[model samples]
Target: MVSPMITEKVISNAPYAASAVTVIAGFTVKDWGVIIGVVLTFITVIVNWVYKHRQDQRESALFNQKINHHQKHKNN
Candidate 1:
């Protein structure tokens, strides 16, 4: 029974409505700050882990190449 225009409006306003509800439900500014900080920390940790993994792979490859070169020269 809902019209397309009404559905669009509700979807657009959904975030605002949810935010208002959370405030009314006693979610204070400090709670939001802590939530944001925790999310940022988690994202940072994931990024660092990925970077370290890639670096380790590069070092392993380089070491293998050096070992191969040394072995080839030694066999000559």
Candidate 2:
């Protein structure tokens, strides 16, 4: 099923492939810096979300304990 013409074309273009690959793969310094910035921003958002979730859970537990204590005193 393979064509000889296509194989010959691929062999002819193979010599220039490295330069083409480098041009595609080469990221500038600014590109790397922006990528790092975006990653850090994502991590910071996740950490803040987890921290807030834990704080809310702790506050809810304390509130429940306070309500129970007050109700017991009122019943007596």
Candidate 3:
């Protein structure tokens, strides 16, 4: 039980949808700088991760030394 008015409206918009798809499909990427920018962005993230890991290791070692010193003082 389809209405003729609704069917006409849908049929009219079908060509526009196809045209929009064609336009989008024809688009192209034309930039070398953008590709290089993405690569450097990932490199910066990796370097930051390594630096943070080393900082955490140093902090953990310092905390352990402090705890050992406290235990030695308490026993004496």
Best lDDT goes to which candidate?
1
Q: Per-residue lDDT tens digits of candidate 3, residues 1-76?
A: 9999999999999999999988867656744467678899999999999999999999999999999999999999
Q: Native-vs-model 2 lDDT?
A: 0.94
TM-score of each: 0.68, 0.68, 0.57
- The candidates, ranked best first by lDDT, are 1, 2, 3
Over 1-76, each residue of candidate 2 has an lDDT whose tens digit, in order, gives 8799999998999979977888758988888799899999999999999999999999999999999999999999
Candidate 2 TM-score over all chains jointly = 0.68
lDDT of predicted model 1 = 0.96
Estimate candidate 1's RMSD in Å. Answer: 4.4
Each prediction's number of clashing residue pairs? 0, 0, 0
CA RMSD of all predictions: 4.4, 6.8, 7.0
- Candidate 2 pairs with clashing backbones: none
Pick by TM-score: 2 or 3, better one = 2
- Which scores higher on lDDT, 1 or 2? 1
Clashing pairs in 1: none
User: Model 1, 1-76: lDDT tens per residue?
Assistant: 9999999999999999999998767968888799899999999999999999999999999999999999999999
